[model samples]
Target: MTSRQPNHKIPETNIKKRIAVITLKSPAHLYHCVPIACELAKNQKFKVDIYTDTEQTAALIKALTEDYNVSCRIQILHPALGNRLLNTLTRHPARAKHIISHNQDKFRHYDCIISPDFYTAPLITTSEKNRPVHVFTFHGAGDRAYGFKQQLCLYDLILVSGPMIKQRLGEEGILDCTHSVETGYPKFDLLHHTAPKKLFSNHRKTVIYAPHFQRKETSWYDWGLEVLEYFYSSRKFNLIFAPHVLLMTKWRRRKSIPKRYYTSPHLHLDFGSSNSIDMTYTQQADIYLGDVSSQVYEFLYHPRPCIFLNTKKVNWRHNPDFTHWQ
Candidate 1:
């Protein structure tokens, strides 16, 4: 493959280049590259503006801006609709069209737009008069069963994580690597930080069960409850249930999983623990048990020990590298 730097270039700019960081969801997607963005801005040679959906993320970016003294402007992507309103619009096209027309122009006025949702939103900005660059970062689970390749072809630049992903995309005949880059994850830079305090300060043994969302025969609703039951009753360790964040929201309007499982007192369910940027739990947890999730790579930064659920053993043996755990 071409050099990683060429793909995700750190182009030298004598003057600060105005950058717009667009966060459609949680800033967790920014975890992979935000630090680099922050550093580039700190040089007094780059200005970074962040557009996020929530005040929580805006506040976080504001604090980072103050700490770094960079021009970190925060703005909301207007014309956003609540679940109730969106549901109503689905039934009424006239109302949806009005809402769409109102927010059409809010997408312009940016030099480069970096989005984590990995969809067509970034490309939408390219139609503006200035014609800014759009970058899409893949944050979803990649599988052969799913038609992910077709979905990925829509972006200008598709930034992937590891060498395995690079190889897989190439084998799939995805010639889009002309804009693809394997930037060694910026989030893993945390492992390089000199934090005095340990990531986890507890006497109790910890086990993190981070399961991926399964489609048919295998599901968190199916076999995962049993695993949770075992962890809840066991006195040997403290348990963390960090399921794929989308599983709770994507399938249904399930807000938060109730803490009723804490009947044993050793389990902590972090359904409310949300962060756009840093997920430090993967660094702190003692043992990680998960299915097919990318958190395994983050967990590997510390490399304590891990277990794969393997509830569905369809054909991972044919392609070992597909699974991060292998």
Candidate 2:
């Protein structure tokens, strides 16, 4: 179902437009959204509110807003206990359903909903009158085919990071009738000054082996263990075995991470921690080794050596999914 395309005429008076910025699924979505909410909060014509579920998310919102020095109403939501309990068993595909089921009336009153994801709003909810205009700020700016292959046309407005994303979405015809604007990466605007932890004792060069969570395309399902063993046994470089946040987010419940990976001083294995989402691994690693994780781009901020492992013997060259490889 499609949202109401933002056809509302610009207000000539001082009436404040109410907007809701939601940060759900906790894998770098908040970083992309805080700046947008902060910017809107600066204007008198807009009344921005931040809605989230977890204490971790609320705390993050507080910290980020403090950094920006922008104050707005932050609504911390506690979804039904059953939904929270169920979310622990499966992936986050059920999150949107809970958000919609729990906050239907509250969301309908907003003039707009600015989310870090597209489908998190209209992708799940049915089209109905009084629904807020969903403005999705595309967060996963990676080259994975999943990024471009989605039904992005559902949102009322799409905010992209750069021209590359705009061009890619336009080429895919996702922008045919959608209202989108390139606002640049809002996360980057808040340059986090927090330094990474001192993991290894030695002064050896650090290497981060960050793999994506996708079962079909990620190197973790096939080559993850081998990579971990290689770094653990070799001990030549300090290895940061930090996979995508979603990997542990989903699988950490069903299976337990082998304790041996954490035995070595050279091996620093993190599964879904605040540091994992923050730029701790990205800033500390001297080299990047991974599959299809978008965090590689963040690691490239300092210009380091990167090695992308192709677990599946697919022809990635000239493929739109592997555009970042080019």
Which digits, one per residue and each the tens of the lDDT, describe model 1 over residues 127-164?
Answer: 53465566665654344334245445545566776676
Ten-residue region with minimum lDDT total, candidate 1: 1-10
- Give the clashing residue pairs of candidate 1, or none: 16-45, 27-276, 28-276
Q: What lDDT tens digits, residue by residue, belong to model 2 across residues 198-278? A: 777898899998888778888887878888778878847889988887777765532655678778888988887777777
Model number with the top TM-score = 2
Q: Assess every candidate by TM-score.
A: 0.75, 0.87
Model 2 scores a C-alpha lDDT of: 0.76
Cα-based lDDT at residue 257, candidate 1: 44
The runs of at least 3 residues in candidate 1 whose Cα sits more than 4 Å from the true structure, single-residue gaps closed, are: 1-15, 63-69, 80-84, 87-107, 120-129, 140-148, 190-202, 250-260, 275-277
Give the distance in Å from residue 132's predicted Cα in candidate 1 to where it truly belongs.
1.7
TM-score of 1: 0.75
